[model samples]
Target chain A: MIELDVTKSHVLHQWKADSPLIACRFSPTGDHCVSTSQDNRLQRWNIADGQKVVLEGHESWVHALTFNKTGDQLISGGCEGRLIWWSILEAQPKAIRSVEAHAGWIRGVEISPDGGMLVSVGNDQVIRLWKTDTGEKLHEWPAHERHIYSAAFHPDGQHLLTGDLLGKICVWKLSDRTLVRTLDAATLYSPNKGQNAEFGGVRSLAISPNGNEVYAAGTHKGSNPFGAVHEPLLLRFNWADGALTKSHVCDGIPGGLLYRAAALNDATLTAVSGGSSGGILLFFNATQEKEFHRAGLPSLARDMDIHPAKGLVATAHFDQHLRISALFA
Target chain B: MSNRARYACGSMDHALSRRRFLGASGLLGASGILGGVASLPSKVAGAIPKNDYRVVVFNMHGGLSQLESWDPKPSTNTGGPFRAIATSVPGIHISELLPKTAKQMHHLCLLRGVNTAEDDHGKGAYMMLTGRRQTPAAEYPQVGSVAAKMLHDDQTGLPGHIIITPGGGGGRGNEAAYLGPKFNSIHLGGDKPPQNSNKPDAIAQEAEERRHLLRRKINEQYLSQRRSAITDAYTHSYEQALKLMERREVFDVSKEPQAAQDKYGNSELGRQCLVARRLLENGVSFVQITHSNYDTHNDNFNFHIEQVGEFDLAYATFIEDLAERGMLEKTLVVVLSEFGRTPNINLYYGRDHWSKAWSVAMAGAKIVPGAAFGQTNKEGTEVVDGQVDHGDIFHTILRGVGVDSSQSLIVDGRELPIADPAAEPIWKVLV
Candidate 1:
């Protein structure tokens, strides 16, 4: 039996700061994790020693951050609607490129598979694709009539998947920025109330290792007067046609709000989701065709990263702590 | 303005003439004029007066089982537990639960074999409401939206279209769809009378004075911004809202006579139907009343019994009240659902989703009375003859209301037909 030790085995790392941290990510090498705080600073922390290397430039809170595929560069988006890219080389510790990307708050950002293109979506309801090397605008498409919450690049770098505030997911062909297909997320819910809940937009997206399947997780509130009951939904869509093939409900997953998800391998995945009540890490193995297994970590788990060379799962929580665990079977 | 000055203006003369005509015609209580005009020969189109017809579609949100409602198949095993009874019209029959409706069958033309492509509730609701299958590029407008688009009168002091107790089932496609929100039906969220109709006496006088001043301000602003389409649409909606606010009496069901309430029953569905009748009487082009909770996956018999009881009393009273008020002939009343239940009862003692052979009923307007349009199989599993799909039903409704069904909407440089390009209206139902 796999036993959980919350009292004695809990690992908590606390960094005292003046403001709350909104987003965090691990370096591709997993040696360090970068956190963006409401204090308008991006702190790079040594995973072993817990020392911080703080990078300060943004005038406002940093809302999102990510690393490029090769793990040689870091990019952060903020309320300033500008994308700041940093070189990971030891000699250059500052941002290498800063591009004015959108007219509104940058809601999401993704790096292309080959690390050649960077895409950002925002409250402006527009998706801007850029050449990562020069920060030159490549193409732009008005993806939805409402705010876009999340976006991702296809594994082959030829297409893009995006979700809107209305709970609609669309597949776009990158060459001309044309909408190829749309997946109605409402179908995944119980058919009775599904139609009324279709407008609850997707908040997070993850692509499988082989790129054949893309998973979108969304949040919908019921229509009762007091307030809608928040439910987190996971949908798997065919990467090529954007056809929604299957759906699973992560009902009441520690945190009612799902903030981030990532594919751990071809068949295994992990998600970080929660709200005011706090969050937990959820693990699922698509290869086994079994129910999702909860990893039982206690905190407001916000984002997660998986080691490329090893099977280590690292999660960042709002409580200013990090938990690293390995899958056991 | 002085009364004499108002009279000196020709507008008062027109108002007086209209009022006199209305009084002489007994408050337009006779439906013969409207129905006669709809059924007039096409060559005499120019001779018919304007603003004569109205349509009210009461959509049962889910598929109400045929065996428990309009077309009971008591002789077959698939019929379940309901028994059939004869209607006032010779040789016509309806479920026993609808005793009141059976007595008013002379005004109903039940279409017994309607079919559609989708079985899922979301897609099926879209198909039934919009009369078109779901497509990627465009969404077709609902029948009410189309009717409002074609028949709305700028001078009319009421909403061109309205939907009562909406959001029961299906998506927001129940509105205008591709026609955009401007043409979408103004939804009344619950069974309660509209908000404007609920003003207290103390606020009513003050509100009226403020409304007059606001109207003048709005007209001035609109006059200056006449060149913008957004401004135009806003002005149109504002003017319609003003007109609707002035006609609060139309939404006040309490003001209706006790006999009228008794005839329409005391349920929310009855009140909604009564409200639809009142709006139609006030020259509203289209009104839709949705009755929910028809999704009977289990306890199908007991559920339908209660549902049909409500429908039978409310629907029958609505038809009778309209006829007694002489509004039935001019208003087209349609009863439809997303689809029908399966012919066979499942192990759960419920009929599953079936789109193969269902029934819809039409009455009033230009429909021929005491008629059934098609036949179902012996076991009632499939359509045996005169099969009709969503498009056919669409064309039939448009035809009943005297609109050309062959028209098409142009979207993205593509011409999409209003009805199915391959289907035709059921000629037997129309005169």
Candidate 2:
């Protein structure tokens, strides 16, 4: 078992992908990390050895990835809205099934905690649910007025949360596939410029362990059409109470952008994917007053993933490096 | 009255006058205002009345990504999310985002290699529009002004050059520079006709006619003493603006069946294109329609989808409309930009300005239909062959629309070629 620790921040290991690293995720064992790149390759890196394996199938940029509970099966989504299922159990990874899931770019993909179901959201403005064991599409529904960005399942696997470009958070009960609540997340989205195609929407989203809350982050404070919202934003929702408790703007940096966010113990971990500047990682407690940790990244951190057992955070950057950070005890 | 679609030409005049408050007479053009039209190649001039060729330029104010537009590098890293689709031409392919335009490829001449040496927005725009570099030496007339000076016939009862939504920050200079304000466009757009074009509901039509008659009499008295080119220019500018007011009904598209407007897609670009067709049909020699904010420094893919979605439908519909009206063979439609986006994608998912190996699309008279000319190297980083620059682009455009590029602008005794002398028209793209 990997040791768990929390203390001073430092880079643990980094593997160079040599192209814009788009999405990163930790394997079920936590000994390995998988990253998708603009080069259209999915790379598996040995966290300890720095060795790597490239699984190629995507014809264009790959933005989303999810691994099955067994860790042997992985599914990735790409700009072409393709869902390619890879069998990572073999010494050489191979694509098992590739489905033309959405009509346009696949924005995000995730699996249920039980790994029985897979969910994918795309610019086609729809969210689709699929069987993990088979490629059977279980359910599909229009999720947003505009392009949908990220989707994640609650730890209990009872609820699914999705975000979109129009600052809308849709909570759906997985059993009935009915929307439980609709939260207006306009604070995390820049109003005037959010509708423009040039600005991305609620790019990253995370749900709390108990399914009681969600933190959505993307960009805020867009002033015009030419320049995107550089200011990174975070909105914390208490769904059980039906209130947005905290709206946090990543301060100290002007025009910062938040690309991906994950629900930490009591804080929200955000990846500020600098529009044209640089990327940053920030952790804000539930109240938005205290910051647990913050670090500057080399370039835009397109997407990130948190380790299941080791408390590790892996960031995929445009600089072509997948950087890892771990908490120390 | 629906007040939405109305735009006043006076606001532009005020804005220009504000910039050139101390309006100086041309240090460029000679004291003869009519010299410009008379200087047109004589043999071509008389035939032009029978020919009646027109030009419509769609200026994408900011740079457009070649990968996402006319040139698609599908397997390249910078290709982003889009795929290329085959056009009507067997081998030519364009961005799938332009599905509508894809079908109309047979009507287009795609110039995939344009290396205009300037990169900055202002300078690049000036060079692309004028066929002249940004020089402190003198301001050159834009393509519209040149078309106006060459093709305008007063008998048409319309302004020769009309720019829809002119303030798109291409820094379209006032006074038409050496060509003078006489050839400058009459700016008009929006929900209503040019403001104050129709006398207020309170004013009787006879009263307005009386006011115009009195003004014309007063203008005659002033013109007798001030008979120089500068005086003639001011008179002509006011006269043209008045002529537009009389013909303002052309701005109202409601007269057309709703089905016609629906066909154009109802977006801003759509409305402007519909207006462009109306203007062109009514004898506007040159019409420049601008669509804004393609400066996608971030989220290039998404923006291209949105911007080009509007552009594709509107442009295709407009082209088809013109063809159905039998105007395509006599009108030149060109889509141009300051430059293309870089082949190198940035960390922002954006591409910066790239001058090398950009592309422009042209259709109508004299253009070789469905031919994709020039070639960019693999990865779309550079032009490997047929490297035509902005001057050459202007030369080809002038030729296709029947403008004589060899004509001289007799400015202050210095002769300047209509287009840059060093550049020649791409004959392969011409009929």
Candidate 3:
């Protein structure tokens, strides 16, 4: 794995799209990048030549995407509650098949370590598992009472963690599909009474490479959610006992939400946050309570993912651009 | 200004007659319409007619997003995540956030091209409610006040105008302008009756009666010596207050059947809507219900999910109830807001204020049911057809309630048009 030195990070390239981008991911092989836009189209970018190919199928915003272990197949879920599988690495990647996955917005989708199973969660408050290649339903269970926002698989491939709008993180043993434990990232949720609203849920989740820890990111202290008055919060949890280990926050960045997070290693993590002011990429040491390094973006970012081979980060932004940045000099 | 005759008429139906039927009533005088006590023989009070024309305004406080309510551009770059579901009107569709309201669309008209051109909360609210641009030089009367004056039933004892707010302190609002204090709106907090509306138990019935008799005697002596609009307004308020106290139960939603309260839901807006329906049924000429905090600068989709969800159940139930009671044809229902949220979703996952292109809804009275007038672009960024503004809406509202929008009121010897003269009613959507 490439060593990450966030302080040396710099923008590598900026690719423009027709509409604001919501989420992006780097292919496992690190040669291809994919992004979803507000225009309801997904685009795959060839890293070396920058050639773009549209992967069109979703009838609504595609908010979540992931790749198979072999990097030959891609899966995505959208606001319309449809899931699609794409033929990645092809000259003109196309949707292989599509299926009605959830009754509401599919907030998250993840490929299990072995690439045989896929886990998805959504506004329907149901966690569904499917066979990656066949697009067939494997198992389904009522996960939470509120909308589920994110999901992650333990590196060990035995447990799955799902977070919800109420800031609850449920751990399920993949074998029986039964909840093994419930963890709290309560700081990531808030009830904004002034607007008669409940907001600030667990927006993104990431498990450490060693499977010893997990991270959840969202907004906190949302006093006036309608006015965009809040701050970003990232919680670290001990995977073994489900204890809240650390709370990482950026005091200077108010009215912001940590929309996406990724564990670079067992001791370090990266998160992208955005608000009315703008967006920022933050680097945190798992043991610390504050970000160690922060970099500002040209506009608000909706999602981020790191390249597996080079540890380069790709950020999807509201300015209709996907920014690629290297985490080392 | 005071040289003008106090009894000058306004509407074309009473044009140039130079006599105000309301002023001629003299049951308690102008002030008695405010809330204070005044002496009048109980036999003089006329029963309100069931068929009296009325107007109901749903003031959506803070900007409501057209993209999430009346107009949904699902799957578009600016549409967010909601789908546009089919309404009861067959081809008509609205944001799924208002599914319940959609079921009642056959009885409503959607004004899809509204461009008031003002975005500030205070200014937008002023324009939407007053039908005129806000200027330091002049203040226009609000729509409720105008409706009250135009539809005032001299025979009826209830206040002509009433506003139900979520957490308002019940009282009178100075929205009447030159119409005189009598047309000002009386506020009610949620479904509760006006504050201090009941006679205190601390006072004996005999003593209270004796005190009222003495006060009337003194007022009679003073009126004999000096009689003017000011004194009449003050004294008249008392009689109106007495009437309100006598029928205070009309504002109490608790008296409604348990099923009704449940149908309206248990949200704050639900309760306000129930009270609004009660007042309208009791012959209040104009009623306004305010649902608040739609100013979503962050978490727009989530906030709308909660706010609009609350609105759908209550508002839909209210419209359905009015129709079932056969009162809809004589009552105008308007759902409006200061402005609409932007089509562009900001970084905070919210939409800011947008007034260039939006939508409003109207139903009942003389409106064309199951009709959708005007049009917005595919992305809802601009109005593409049948554009109208606040002035037009004001005129349409009056015309819907059988009031002549072209008429002018003789106030203080000056001719004040009931609505803006520069604009006319949205005739296409009117019956």
Query: TM-scores for all candidates?
Result: 0.49, 0.91, 0.88
Q: Which sequence of candidate numbers ranks them by DockQ, best first? A: 2, 3, 1
Residues A1-329 of candidate 1 have per-residue lDDT tens digits of 33322122233445533334567777877777777754567777666777777787665446667788777788888755788988753433698888878765687888888888889997688999888777889888787986687898888778898887667788888888888888776532221231111224576878998998888775544221012235556777777677767665665442255567788766666675555336656666564332367555566555666664545566655555555555542
Q: Sort the candidates on TM-score, descending order.
A: 2, 3, 1
List fnat, each candidate: 0.00, 0.41, 0.55
lDDT score, candidate 2, position B277: 87
TM-score of 3: 0.88
lDDT sort, best first = 3, 2, 1
Estimate every model's Cα lDDT from 0 to 1: 0.67, 0.76, 0.83
**What's the DockQ for every one of the candidates?**
0.01, 0.40, 0.35
State residue A109's C-alpha deviation in candidate 1, in Å.
70
Best by lDDT: 3
What docking tier does model 3 reach?
Answer: acceptable
lDDT (tens digit, per residue) of candidate 3 on B1-431: 12111110111311221232344234224422322222222111123223378999998877789999999999887999888999999989999888899999999999999999988776787798889997755657789988887787745678999988755556676666566667777878767889999999999889988988998899999999997666776677788987788899998889999999999998878888888888877888899987776788777887787789889999999999999999899989999998999999877678988999999999999999999999999999999999999999999998999888888765444556879999999999998
Q: Give me the runs in candidate 2 sitting further than 4 Å from their true place.
A: A1-7, A191-200, A224-229, A266-277, B1-50, B166-175, B190-192, B411-414
- What is the alpha-carbon lDDT of model 3 when measured against the actual structure? 0.83
